[model samples]
Target: MSSEKIIQKIGQLYHQKLLMLVKDVSLVLVVVVAIVESVVRLLVVVVVVVVVVVVVVVVVVVVVVVVYSSSSKVVVVVVVVVVVVVVVVVVVVVVVI
Candidate 1:
């Protein structure tokens, strides 16, 4: 009977240790899941910022091209007008003199 009690006590101790191991494993799993979630969120934010910056750069490039082309056209028109006015003034002065 004394040996029987010793065996039962040993069995109980083994069961307690198993429960503790399971609890530790579960805690470690929860921490790992949290870390993974944080990493995913950070990656998502980075992707969004990159996309926004790319779009802004494209828009600015397009606007600059359009504005520069239109400004070039205006410069050409002004040059032609100035040449015509100068020719007219020279002819008028020759006739008057």
Candidate 2:
């Protein structure tokens, strides 16, 4: 029948349109997923770099404190020794004269 043929053709065209819409949706989904993955990767790299910089700064601060403390102790010892030597010499000279 002519009506039957027209109905069949219309059904085929509808099916084809549905397939095309599905393909377009799939392509859009893939692009969205790729964009999300890239953003996550970038955030991870930024976090890692920030952590490493913080660790390095802490290490440097600790090293500076240790070095300054040791040097200050050495300076105190040297000053004490010099004062003792000068006092002893002055006392000896006063006694001899």
How many backbone clashes can be found in candidate 1?
Answer: 0
Runs off by more than 4 Å, candidate 1: 69-97
**lDDT for each residue of candidate 2 in 44-90, tens digit (9 for 90 to 100):** 66765665565556556555665677687765665565556556655
Cα-lDDT of candidate 2: 0.71
Report lDDT (Cα) of residue 86, candidate 1: 51
Error of 2 at 59 (Å): 1.0
What local distance difference test score does each model get? 0.71, 0.71
Q: After superposition, how far is residue 53 of candidate 2 from its true place, in Å?
A: 0.7
lDDT of 1 by residue, 65-95 (tens): 6567768776566556555655665565445
Give the CA lDDT, 0 to 100, for residue 91 in model 1: 62
